[model samples]
Target chain A: MKARVTVTLKNGVLDPQGKAIEGALGALGFDGIGSVRQGKVIDIELGETDKAAAEAKLSDMCEKLLANTVIENYHIDIL
Target chain B: MKARVTVTLKNGVLDPQGKAIEGALGALGFDGIGSVRQGKVIDIELGETDKAAAEAKLSDMCEKLLANTVIENYHIDIL
Candidate 1:
C-alpha cells in the first residue's frame, strides 16, 4: 500500500520561507499573487495492505516523527 | 482562486533527505516501511478567477521557478 502525508503550518503561524517564495515570484514578474504558503509531502510505501491499518499507522507516524503538532498540522491519505 | 503545486524528485534521482527520513523512521520503530520520498507542496492564492488561466499561469510558474524540469516533476491543482 502507498500512503501520503502532508504537513502544513497551522493558521496564525509565520512562514518566512513562503514569504521568500512570494517575493521571488513577484520579482519574476508573476502578478496578482495574494499569498503563498509552503508545506511538505511525504510518500511512503508500506508492506501493510489493509486500508484502515495503513491509515492508522500513518497517523501514528505523523504524530511521532513527521510533524510537530504544536505548530504544524498533518493529514494522511492512503493511496 | 486557490492553487496547489506539488514538486517531487524524479525517479532514479538520489534523494538524501528522503533517505535520512527513512532512516529516522526506522530508528523510531516504524515497521514494514519500504521506500520513502519527500516533496514540496506550495499553496498559492491567486486573484484570478478563471480556472484555465490560473492553471496556465501556475504551469508557467512551475516551469520558471517551482520545479527543476531535469530532475523534478510538478503537478498543479486548482481548488
Candidate 2:
C-alpha cells in the first residue's frame, strides 16, 4: 500500500518563503501569477493494512508529527 | 481559474529541514514514519484565462522562480 501525504499551512499563516517564490516567479516573467504558498509531501508505503486501520494510523501520523495542528492541516491518499 | 503549484527538491538533495521535521515527528511519538520530505505549494487564482496560456505562464513561473529547474520539479493543477 502507498500513501501520499500533504501538509500545508492553514489560512492566515504568514509565509515568507511563499512570498519569495512569488516574487521570483514574477521576476521570471510569470505574469498572472497571483500568489505562492509552500507545503510538504510525504510518500509512505505501508504493507497490507486494512483501510480503517490505515486511516486511523495516517491521521495519527499527521496529528502526532506530519502537521503542526496549531498552524497546519494534512490530508492523505491511501492506495 | 485556480492552479496549485508545487516545488520540491530533487532526489539526493540534502534536506536538513526535512530531517529536522522527521526528528521532531519521532520525538512526538510518530512511529513507523520512515522518512519525510518537504516541498512547496503555490495556489493562484487567474480570472478567466485559457488553460494553454496558464500552462505557459506556469511553466515560466516554475522555470524562472517557483522551482529551481536544476534541482526541483513542479506540477500545476488547474481547477
Candidate 3:
C-alpha cells in the first residue's frame, strides 16, 4: 500500500517561511495572493496490504516522528 | 479561493533528508517501511475567484519560483 502524510502548522502559529514566500510572490508581480503557509508531505510505500493497519501505523508514525503535535497537525491518506 | 501546491523531488534525485528519515524510522522500531520521500505542500489563499485563472497563475508561479523544475515536479489543486 502507498500512503501520504501531510503535516501542517496549526492556526495561530507564526510561519516565517510562508511569510517569505508570500513576499517573494508579491515581488514577482503575482498579485491577489493572500496568506501562504508551508508544510511537509511525505509519501511512503509500505509492505502492508491491509488499509486499516496501514492507517494505524501511519498515525503512530506521525505522533512519534512525522509531526510536532504541539504546533502542527497531520493528516494521512492511503492511496 | 484556497489552493494547494505540492512540490516533490523527481525520481532518481538523491534525497538525503528522506533517507535519513527512513533510517530513523527503522531505528524507532517501525518496520516494513519501504521507500520514503519528502515533499513540500504550500497552502495559499487567493483573492481570485475564477478557478481556471487561479490555476494558470499558480502554474506560472511554480515555473518561475515555486519549483526547481530541473529536479522537482509540482502539482496544483484549487479548492
Candidate 4:
C-alpha cells in the first residue's frame, strides 16, 4: 500500500519561504499572482498491505516527526 | 482563484533529503515503512478569477522559477 502525507502551515501562520517565492514570481513577470503558501508532501510505500494499518501508521508518523503539530497540519491519504 | 503546484524529483535521481528522512523515521520507530519520497506543494492565490488563465499562468510560473525542469517534474492544479 501507499500513503501520502501532506503537511501544511496552519492558517494565519507566517510563511517566509512562501513570501520569498511570491516575490520571485513577481520578479519573473508572473503578474496578478497573489499570496503563495508552501507545504510538503511525503509519499511512502508500506510493506504492510492492510489499508487501515497503513493509514494509522502514517498518521502516527506524521504526529511523531512528519509534521509540527503546533503550527502545521497534516492529512494522510491512502492509495 | 486558487492553484496548486506539486514539484517532485524525477525517478532515478538521488534525494538525500528523502533518504535522511527515511533513516530518521526508522530511528524514530516507524516500522514497516518502505521507500519514502519527498516533494513540495505550493498553494497560490490568483487575483484573476478565470480558471483557465490562472492555470496557464501557474504553468508558466513553474517553468520559470518554481521547478527545475532538468531534474524535477511539476504538476499544476487549479482549484
Candidate 5:
C-alpha cells in the first residue's frame, strides 16, 4: 500500500518562501501570476495491506511529525 | 484560477533524504514502514481566467524553473 501526504500552510499564515518564489517568477517574465504557496508531499510505501489500518497509522504519522498543526493543514491519499 | 504542481523524484535516483526520513520513522516506532520519498507541491493562483492559457503558462513555468527536469518529474493540475 502507498500513501501520499500533502502538507500545506493554513490560511492567514505568513509565507515568505512563497512570496520569494512569486517574486522570482514575476522577474522571469511570468506575468499574470497572482499568488504562490509552497507545500510538501510525502510518499510512503507501507508493508501493511489493510486500508483502514494504513489510514489510521498514516494519520498518526501526520499528527506527530509530518505536519505543524498550528500553521499547516494536511491531507492523506491512499493509493 | 488555481493550479497545483507536484514535483517528484525520478525512479532510480539516489534519495538520501528519503532514507533519512525512513530512519526517523523507524526510530519513532513506526514499524512495518517500507520506503519513503519526499516531493514538493507548489500552489499558484493566476490572474488569467482561461483554463488552457493557464495550463500552458504553468507548464512553461515548470519547465523553466519550478522543476529540475533532470532528476524530477512534475505534474500540473488546473483547479
Candidate 6:
C-alpha cells in the first residue's frame, strides 16, 4: 500500500523556514503571495495491503514517531 | 498578507528524508504503513495587501528562490 502523510505547523507557531520562503518570493517579484506557512509531507510504502491494517499502522506511526503533536498536525491519505 | 507554500519532491524522485521517516515509523511499531515521502512547507509574510500582487510575487518566488523545479514542485495557499 501507498500513503501520504502531511505534517504542518500549528496555528501561531513560529516558522523560520516559512519566513525565508516569503522573503525569497518577494525578491523574485512574486506579488500573489500574502502569507506563507510551511509544513512537511511524508509518503510511505508499506507491505500491508489491508486498508484497515494500513490505517492502524499509520495511526501508530503518527502518534509515536511521525509527528510532534505539540506544534505540528498531520493528515493521512491512503493511495 | 500571509501565504503557505509547500515544496515536495517530484514524482519518481528519490527522497532520502522520506525514507528515514518511514524507517522511524516502522521501528516505532507502525505495521500498516506502506510508504512515506517527505516534503517541505514554507510560510511567507507579505507586506502587500493586493491578492494579485501577492500571488505574482509568490509565483516568482517559487520559480526562482523557493523551489527547485528540476526536482521539486510547490503549491501556494493564500491565508
Question: What tens-digit string does per-residue lDDT give for candidate 2 at B5-68?
Answer: 7777888988787788778767876566665667777777665379988877777767766678
CAPRI-style grade of the A/B interface in model 5: high
The numbered model that scores best in lDDT is 3
What is the iRMSD of the candidate numbered 6?
A: 3.3
- Off-target runs (Cα >4 Å) in candidate 4 are none
lDDT of 5 by residue, B5-57 (tens): 99999998988878888998899999998889999999999999999999999
Give one clash count per candidate, in the order shown.
Answer: 0, 2, 0, 0, 0, 40
DockQ, each predicted model: 0.93, 0.50, 0.93, 0.87, 0.87, 0.55
Candidate number that wins on TM-score, 5 or 6: 5
As a TM-score, model 4 comes out at 0.96
Best by TM-score: 3
Task: Name model 2 segments beyond 4 Å from true.
Answer: B20-29
Residue pairs in steric clash, candidate 2?
Answer: A37-B41, A38-B41
Candidate 6 stretches with Cα past 4 Å from truth are B1-5, B32-35, B42-59, B75-79
Worst 10 residues of 5 chain B by lDDT: B12-21
Candidate 3's residue-wise lDDT over A31-55, tens digit each?
9899999999999989899999999
Candidate 3: where are CA atoms >4 Å away?
none
Fnat values, one per model, are 0.90, 0.55, 0.90, 0.93, 0.87, 0.87
DockQ, candidate 1, vs. native dimer:
0.93
Model 1 chain B: worst 10 consecutive residues (lDDT sum): B13-22
lDDT of 5 at A28: 95
Query: In candidate 3, residue B31 scores what lDDT?
Result: 97
Query: Higher-DockQ candidate among 5 and 6?
Result: 5
Give the interface RMSD of each candidate: 0.5, 2.8, 0.5, 0.9, 0.8, 3.3
Q: How well does candidate 6 score on lDDT at residue B6? A: 77
